[model samples]
Target: MLLRLLLLICAPLCEPTVVFLRASPSQPIEGNSMTLTCKIQHAPLKSDAQFCFFKDGQTLGQGWNSFPEFQIATMWKENSGSYWCGAKTASSKAIWSQSIQIDVQRVPVSNVSLEIQPPGGHVMEGEKLILVCLVAGGTGDITFFWYKGALGLNLETKTRRSLTAKFEIPTVTESDAEQYYCAADNGYGPSLSGLVRITVRIPVSRPVLTLRAPRAQAVVGDVVELHCEAQRGSPPILYKFYHEDVTLGSSSASSGGGVSFNLSLTAEHSGNYSCEANNGLGAQRSEVVPLNITVPTEDRKELLTSGVIEGLLGILCPTTIALLFCCWLKRKIGRRSARDPPRSAPSPVPQQPTYLNSPDPVQQQPIYQNVNVVSGDEVYSLVYQMQQELQSAVVEPPRTRNEDKDPSAIYSWLKKANDTDLDYEDAM
Candidate 1:
């Protein structure tokens, strides 16, 4: 009892200057070799001081040794424990080193898998997406990395001693569409997971249908084209053209934009035309476009014949009226000529006798006695014969000026003859 008390009291005075335990590798894989060292700072380098190793408060070996190191050739899971060392001298109390815990882990990770929170990997744009990375058949703390195609995404690393790790994407967009994968590393190496494909679907917008024809009016036997498109839609869109709600034709735009269809127009094709665009999301129809087909005027024989008849009548009616007018004018002229006889040259006026001796000398006029009077029937026959001569002269293109004399002269001569006849009757 007295010796124990003295040892305890002197233990502090002769304690080693510094003592600590260190392992070559703080973490070691299973089946690897490692060395644990116990160092004493105050002891001589070649001192023969005996050292003893302890594991979890138990002695590892039966006795002490001059060396201050412990080696493990083949580490195992069971070899993980807290270890320390103690130094003893013949005249000093024993000194203990600080404790250190060693951990033996399994081999590096060999497999990694990624799974989406919502199965099938189909997600809407602007929605959150969760990805979970799983490590298979590995031990130790692991680091997980997320990747999109060949590019690395900005995701927080997971450094946990667990079999599964999670990575979250706040929002997804059209630009995020690509193949994704993950990797698991445990200091030894990294293992990549299988690729997962993601798709982003877009809804179809209102479609617009436009009609193109060779002329302002669609006619029979003319070719017409219909184009359909959407302002926004996904690729591989199916377009269907409709005429009066009947499907005329269909087309597809593989790269997305627009599609067109052609038709040989007929009379039956005149109706309200529209189109529909679909891309698996939904179908959208465009506003109705009116198409009118006209028939050519030459196609109907009855109408053509009636038009011809009306056109001939329109020409011949005016021509017939003009012909009757010319004939009436010619007959009126012939009758007027027959009533009036042509006037003979005016007779010379009688000359007044000049008498130089008297201021007032009486002028003497010559007096005619027996003038042969023409009968009315003879006058009518002479006027008719003169009219026949005038008509014959008009038929000949070239005539003298005398033959073309004014008809007014003939009228005056007739009046004079009537007056003279009245005077002669009075005288008788």
Candidate 2:
């Protein structure tokens, strides 16, 4: 105690006035608070004395302040460097302190996040897709992994010093749309991000239209259907049918496919037909299809006349054929009879005269001739087969010499005046 009191008087002359730089924590973790100080080694400085701090030959942003220390509220990896301090008085030359070194260790990664470019994860097909995995709080070299859904479905992995890693698809298709996430590790446990869903939109291609009818031809009153389809469009597609540029009808496919529109055909329905398909992006039209509708003719009067004419023809045709056949048969029989005489029956038989010829025209009675039908002939023949009828009630007189010699004398008066000769007909 007596030695310490004696040295106090000579302390100022013996020791030099120098400055020292010190740190609150020589090694600080990233994002932690830290502080640096400029200390005078010997006697106290004047009230007007100023101090400054530096890092690696560069000023630590505070220039000549009455305060002798610098404070770092948060430290980072980039803040690690050599540090020093300096001091000066209004009446004396400036002085500096020896440099000190501080290292701010990097914190382990946490809070991983997955994001998509053209945000919302809504992408069009055939376009590029970018997936970015971010580290909210991490330092040093970090390893990032992108997952579609679970860790088993790993999409990509990258190790670098960057805060974020990216996975890019040059051309995305429908199969690429799904849920995704990311995991980050910086010498620490892996941290997973929330799920991000991707939806792919496919633009409607050119549609195809088809017309189907119940019959071979599309006539009036026929029920036909128009089929419209877009081979590569997304869901809830709207289909519209047109005829000669006029809207006919519309239909939709909520689950994505083809649709049909039924049409009751009429005379006015005949025209060029087409169809269009849309899924909110844009509409596409199909090629024009020509349609023709035919209407039946109306002719009640002509139909009735034709029916009557057909009925008459149907009835008269057979009758005409029968008449012609009969006429031909008659001609054939007449020719046959003329060519060959009949063998079954005699030509004529002699008979007593039924009436005598009178000179007065009014007194003459009509003479009836008997007709016989020959089997092979067609014309009427005068046959005297009624000899028994003529002799039924007539009184008979004994034959005289002249009656015996000329039996045909009884028919003399019925003959013409030029016939003077008479001959007897032999009985067959």
Candidate 3:
């Protein structure tokens, strides 16, 4: 009866207790170390206890004095299986712990970058950029998928056990260039690598160069800037300058592909100048421009100086000759005017005739005389002869009177007859 009572108390005290398993970083990177922890429900009264861990029905480690811990070394593909742990006392049979399934996961990703053909060192539109996904320590079927913004891109697989996967997007456009991610999976949940930022860098179009000058006649040995410009093109272009069929210098344009050159020129550079612009696609040349310079003439200055001294003498000689000729002509004309008279004048008067003549001989007769008068033959004959004698004379006859008794009467009568005859003749 005492032995039966003692056996019943020992049986109740010898029962086994369980410990729970704990892991750090519940998720771990491949090929790196990880720790698993175990804890006992009750501390053993005696320090003599046995602990053992098993995986897939095989022992992992065994110890006579056991603690609540287990560690796996150099974890590889073979270590990926189910695991469990149990504890036992030295005086009792071992008890089992709950089963725990551990799975060896794939490594996290590294080193993802975009590769391009005719690489611009960046991905851009109208250029084909290859996407490569690589893992350091993994071997399985890989699917190359591309993610853009929020969508996934599926690519056909070429190999099953390849650690690297490649995706080819031919003739990439603007939409293809985006933030991209690639994932590798062998029946494991998707582990996305980092991102590849794609920037579509469009190449510059054909550039055009134009040149200008502030003035048409750009003098030699003078400061001048020749402007070079592009009409339609992308920026960041390089420009080269030329002068007089010879190259001078080079420059770059960042924004508008416009550049200028400041040249302190010499006489040898006074000719055509041109410029060329390029941006990898092609090059353009500006039109040829010409420059000229002017200088003072030495001969012209000497000629002007000599002309000043002789100018007054040359002017006065001709003026003096002309004045002398004009004075002589005026004096000759005055003398001719004084010597000539006008034709309009009156004529002289003629002499008158006068009459006073005594050229012919003449005779005078008596004024009166007395005479007798008878009518008988003797008296008649005497009277007839006296009358005949009186008729013969050319002069006027004398007057006569009675002879004897009346002499005084005869004078008176004769004077009266004379007076009557004078009166009768003057009347006729």
Candidate 4:
């Protein structure tokens, strides 16, 4: 019929193209091995074309022979999908190509987890810190990396097979603490994840109470000590001590810096002395140190009551000034023996003259009338007699004067009255 109408007029003037080449490893991994050729552009190198292979629309292989490649050794997971290739020519009809989509990955029994959003991984340097990686039982396109201790951070890809994969750190320092994990690859090998340690909290700082006294004069049984510190805290701190507000001792530095507290001094431990450091992120204090307490002159009842009050004022002040000067010299010798006085007693020796004229008295006394007789001689005689008689006896002595005498007998009676008045005037 004119060679069948010249092969349908040369198949509408040579138009036959069924490409589908490229796929050596376009994306294949599950047990690996791939290849998919199938050309046939302008057909007719001897035509009679026969190459086949289609997928999404079924029909894997029905004809092949010249330049029709299509392998897939071992690759599974249903050998993925979307493939194309066709070219029939024994007289034309059927031509398809262009449709390659063979994915197949699946080497991922992964299971990489590492989530920490606001869950106690304790963040505070500046805040905000999330990790998350997940990706369990993966299969096709899946990347997700993110590490931290061994470095290597951020990397996510999950084309359409996701399960989770995040990574943020908007702040959070102190070298970001460290130790975190997550990984998952999908093209096989690489599934890490199981390490999570990140802590960065820091707060407690105002403490600094230092006393340490072995002797700067904190006496009364001394022992003192007390050091407490907190330069830049972040540990198990907790150091407390205070004194005018009571609560005296407590110490616990647990790996950080300072802590002491001994104290034994008494006298009420004087006064104001503070310190507190806590570490749960707050609680500071410290700054009020006074502490006085002193009373040691080698005390022993205060040195025996100051030596018995200075030995009773040094023995009653000189025995009360020598007993007031012996009572003022016994009242000045009894006021000088009552001012002066008394002596008296001594007299009598005039008898001789009396007798000289008395004897005549007796005889002449008889002449009474006017006897004018001239008797000069007789008168003399009579006078004598009368004098004698008159001179009579005189005797008066003993009127008490013997105060136990003997002051040389009153100077020997004034030397015997001046020798008897000069011998009684030479015996008259």
Candidate 5:
């Protein structure tokens, strides 16, 4: 009993066995790696010893294994605490190593990257754009900077403890479509990220259509030009023209601008016209414009005047000729009667007189029946021969002075010629 007591009393002073945990890096920086080793001071069989690690009284692994060391691939501020290890051997009970307090220090920011939300990195106009500045390794408080183009255009500056920082744009515009960059600083110099291109696409706006002609008024056979333009849009715009809902033609502009299409006017082309502008996103149409083809009133008036003049000449020419021929026939008849005076037969009482063509048994033939077939000279010759015969046959009859001077004897003949017994004559 005294020998066992003496051995126990000498064990602590002579061969003191001290179990402790050793850290390769005494002060580990956040986002760095470290290793912990558990060992015994007087241990001679370390390979047979199994060890397990703990931080702030919480086990790091499932349990004890053959390994006597613990490793941490990454370190953070949350892992800064008092750490210890437990060692167990096949022939002894579990033993706890001395605990050590570790402090994780803050590190400078590095490996900065700028990422755009809604992946593929294209954001249209008026949409929200998010720029996230992230650091692969950093610690403690850090300040993030967002910029566009150069440093003169600093978009935002924020200080936080997170490894990532965000800058949001509620509404993106054309000015925001330039190159972007992000930077991070944690007491050291700023770590700037590479340039990232952020393009803000703009959709096509409503188009405006205009019709141009050589004159103020459009007419048939005029070549009219149709101009379609959108106030704002991206490049490579296509323009299409429509007349009365029918497609006329189309044109394209590689750069953002207007386009024109030529149209020939006709009578059938009078109607509403419109144009459409498309940039692949969608098509926008312009307000309808009306086209009217006109025929001048002066031309129609001239044609009407000429037609009226021709129609009047057709009717009046024939009537004018007929009037002139009647006047000539009347004058010729008066001349014939003036040359031959009427003779009257002496009555049996000798005081009464007879006025007739001839006071003879021979009858005078009507001249009107042969007026169209015979000439005026032939008619006069026949009348003169008959008058000579009549005079020779009835020489006892002669005209009185008052009958030769009668003014009513030369008008025209209206009485029947067969009633020649009455010594009456018809005036020429």
Candidate 6:
């Protein structure tokens, strides 16, 4: 039993036992201190023993101790290689512990920067602008976000060394031009950039005005139209039309700028006219225009018979005088002819039956012969009847001899028997 106890004591003196070794802060930052230790497995030997640390087979340092420990000061980033601990005795060589690796990390970035680029001197109403954000140095996933007027507007994430985000404000109005800011996140936390105020400004261009009339000329008591227009201006601009230094009417531009007003025109309405346009910035006045109106006289009317009355008078007076003179001369000549007597031949009875034994005055006178037409039953019957009469006269011997000797006496006797018929025939 004395011999076994002696063996145990002698064995510890010859070689030392190391149970566990440890390193604080498994993960560490660059340029910071750290510690490494080697612990004995059993109660340390009363006789002094040595402990050491090594890296890739190179010895770091040696010391005598109960348990050996390493104090690394100014542990630079280069000290991040593999390392281990060992325990040694005077009687034997050193024994190494299990190897351990160290890590060095970078700090998260803070206080980012922001830059803005607007389209003009100032952001115009209804105009667009852009904002950019930047950071110093950080790794792994990161997020970017933008804000306007305390409201989150955009957010994004990236794995690259640098990140970018874009913002668009369409149809920027007065309300849109406000304070804006941006921030970055690395999952550890978020850091904010600074904020800036935006202002909007615009100038009103030239305005155009127009006029309209009910007719080419505004006559008395006629209704006329007046109008105003602008060649270039923002919509919803209020327009006021004026005439002769008086306001005619006011209207707002809906699309293309134009407005009209109606007025009952009179002779007094003839004058100059103008208009003004405003969009809350300023008002612009148009050039002056002049107008004049006149009234017309009524048309003349004519009578129905005015043309023919003079012509009728000129024709009738000469015709009446000529007809009266002709009738008066004709009556005078007839009266004169009746008053004058004609030279007549003397009667044969008035001359005495002288110079011979004139048997009788009536017998001495010229005998008148007469012829009479007789009617008959057929065309030659008249001839036949006259022949019969002649034969009868011949057969009566006394009448035949008497007619042959005194044919004039017979003719005279026939004329005297039909005197009215003989006188009528003589007048024809």
Which pairs, if any, clash in model 5?
355-423, 411-428, 412-427, 412-428
List model 6 lDDT by residue over 336-406, tens digit each: 54344323212212223333354332323332222232221111100000011212334544434323232
Per-model TM-score, in order, reads: 0.47, 0.50, 0.33, 0.35, 0.49, 0.35
Model 1 weakest 10-residue run by lDDT: 379-388
**Per-residue lDDT of 1-428 in model 1, one digit per residue for the tens?**
99999999888769746777888888987767888787878556447678888888888766588888888887766788998888877776678898989888877887799998677988777788888999876666788888887566645677877779998878877877778899898787889899888776667789999999999988989999899999887778999999999998898999989988999987678889999999988999999999988878675465578779899989998998998787677656655655654355333233445455764544333222222223231122221101112123345675444453323222211223543453221110
The C-alpha lDDT values of all candidates are 0.73, 0.77, 0.55, 0.66, 0.76, 0.59
* Overall local distance difference test of candidate 6: 0.59
Q: How much lDDT does candidate 3 score?
A: 0.55
What's the lDDT for residue 309 in model 2? Answer: 95
Clashing pairs in 2: none
Compared with the true structure, what per-residue lDDT tens digits does model 3 show for residues 1-428? 89999888776567646565566535444455556665566545446666677778887666434565677644544567777666677676776677766666665333433344445436545666777766554533444455655465544444435567777777776556567667665555555666667666445443333444456665544678777777654457788888865878888887755788888865456667788878665777877766765322553465466676578669887988887777666556544543443232112121122223632322221122222212111110001001112133477545442211122211111113333342111100
lDDT of model 6 at residue 364?
34
Model 4 ranges with Cα > 4 A deviation: 1-27, 30-36, 40-43, 46-79, 87-93, 96-105, 109-125, 128-139, 143-164, 169-192, 205-219, 222-233, 236-252, 255-260, 266-285, 289-428
Q: Which residue pairs collide, candidate 1?
A: none
Best-fitting candidate, measured by TM-score? 2
Q: Which regions of candidate 1 are displaced past 4 Å?
A: 1-82, 85-103, 151-156, 299-428
lDDT preference between candidates 1 and 5, better one: 5
lDDT of 2: 0.77
**Relative to the unseen true structure, what is the C-alpha lDDT of residue 177 in candidate 4, on a scale of 0 to 100?**
78
Evaluated at residue 51, the lDDT of candidate 4 is 75
Model 6: residues with Cα > 4 Å off, grouped in runs: 1-203, 254-256, 295-428
Least accurate stretch of 10 residues (summed lDDT) in model 5? 379-388
